[model samples]
Target: MNLVERDEQESELERIWSECGAGKGSVVLLEGSGGSGKTELLHQAAERARRGGGLVLHAGCSPAESALPFGVLGQLFSSVPAVEGPLARLQAPNSPLAAEAAPHDPARGAVAIGPQLALLLNEVTATLLELSAAKPVFIGVDTVRHADAQSLACLLYLVRRTGAARVMAVLTDDTAAHRSPFRTELLDQPHTRRVPLAPLAEAEITALLARQLERDEAERLAGEFHTLSGGNLLLLRALLEDHLACGGVRKDGYGRAVL
Candidate 1:
């Protein structure tokens, strides 16, 4: 499917590139309701960073991992090679203690792994700094509001340290449901920028539908789809799929329904 309405976000991403290119690493906190295209914007930014010869690392936060120390760090460790050595040194091979100390069961594992996890995360931060020295690094964290305390600590540490490092961090959070600690931390930092994603405008929504359907069909469906989804991209797409399945936008019909 074509990306119908991300021109403004694209421009912001380009502006971030210019800032980073000038040796200013920025943290962009993107806040919106669920299905509001925050993740899509991050994906676009990551793609752009990759094309510009920057390293991109993406991680998602889960409620199951909320108590696990370094849960988000572990997710990030699996992606970027720059931190492999430090993480390896921090974690042992097939150790029962390590397995038992997993982040998901932090209450049971915290006594055994808490201190080690903190030290490991510190090492991870240092490693990231080392990697950033060679080239710009882009880190995308999704659902930051659901992130664990330890993971949030690590993120805050990164923001403080990035003033001297070539790393740009992008985070997405559901603003309607929960507030993000990271967002507060970012706002205090002069280098960080917060971008709130609003619902797509009617014209943009029309353009989006047009990319998926012919002109007349797009015009007809766009209004209905916008009303149903409130211009939330994910819901809009789902509604479109439902409409298509119901033959609401047939190739050869103006107002025909299959059922």
Candidate 2:
């Protein structure tokens, strides 16, 4: 879907992407509520980075695989051959970064992340930094709130050390979700920029409708559509689909579905 009322956000993202290509790495957090277009903006940003000659590594995180160690990391490097060297060892059976490799403090009887994890984090970070030496790298992860603990650690490490490299990491998270300490730390980084997204405005909704229907008809339905969808782009699109399919908005059909 085409973005509406997001020119400023796009411009900011373009600026960040340009700076990343200029060897000024930074982190971007797209924060928004559900159906607020965070994922769409993230994909658009990744496409922009890719078109700008950056090596784009994009992955989506979910609650289903949140417990799978290094799940997000695997998704990121699985398709990129350039960074496969370090990822090979990380994914190998019984590798140092394996789940069992987490250090157990026998004295304190608590699991402590010792040198093993640190080395692995540095190895992954080094791989990206090294790749950036040749070309800019863009790491885009969606729904970081659901990223596994280990992958989140790797991302956090990279975010802290990306200041001088030609690398940019863009992550999206639902503002309504619980903010983990790892996410908090990542957002606290000096170079991190937070972009908060809200639902579309009435005028933007009307503009969106105008793209699909005649201008007068779009204007006629904009108020009711906005009221039903509460300016949510996703819901608004569904309502539009219903209107197109049924020849009008039926409160018992898509209207009820959206509600």
Candidate 3:
């Protein structure tokens, strides 16, 4: 997909990165429903970061590992240049920073997060600032709603102090999904922006199809797809693939579907 109806979203990310490169850090919350191209937009921003000689780190939050503390951060910086020392060691299972405990009292049940975790958090914050001073560092996460509590805590801590450093963090998740309790750290934080995505427009869908099909054929199918898909490109692509597999999408002399 050629980034239909997402110019503003992508441009916002660029603006943030440009500001970060100038020693003004920023954060962006990319909100969208499933298959709304949130991940694609992140990748696009990452490409720009890379081209600008900035370091790009990306992690995807998954249900299978959502229970693991600092799991998203581990995956994010595991291969990156900086933060391979204390921050890297903190991700290990045996590290004291990965401790887990739950008190009997529900009010005190904020266990698994203890003094050791505070040290790790400080280490992450310092490392980010130190690295950002040398080169722009862009951190992006997808499906952020599923991120573990520990990762979110460390990120919130970083967000507070990143305003003066050359760093930018981008987080995204399904717009229809309930907000994660962990995101409270990001709430009311300065320099934070939320971007919600809407479904593609009829013209955008037609242009998307025209990339492969002739204009007349693309316009004809776009009308049906716009209605059938409710402007959802993910569903439209799936339906299109199935239609092609069943030989129902064959073109006539005028390039319209034979049916």
Predicted model with the maximum lDDT:
2
Mind giving the per-residue lDDT tens digits that candidate 1 earns over 114-150? 5655566567778888887787888889988666665
Q: Could you tell me the C-alpha RMSD of candidate 2 in Å?
A: 3.6
Quickly count the clashes in candidate 2: 0
Q: Quote the positional error of residue 233 for candidate 2 in Å.
A: 0.8
At residue 254, what lDDT does model 3 achieve? 16
lDDT of each: 0.71, 0.79, 0.74
Error of 2 at 70 (Å): 0.7
Each model's TM-score?
0.78, 0.88, 0.82
lDDT of 1: 0.71
Candidate 1 vs candidate 2: the TM-score winner is: 2
Q: How big is the positional error of residue 213 in model 3, measured in Å on the Cα after superposition?
A: 2.4
Model 3 local distance difference test score:
0.74
Error of 3 at 88 (Å): 5.0
Q: In model 3, what is the error at residue 243, expressed in angstroms?
A: 5.8
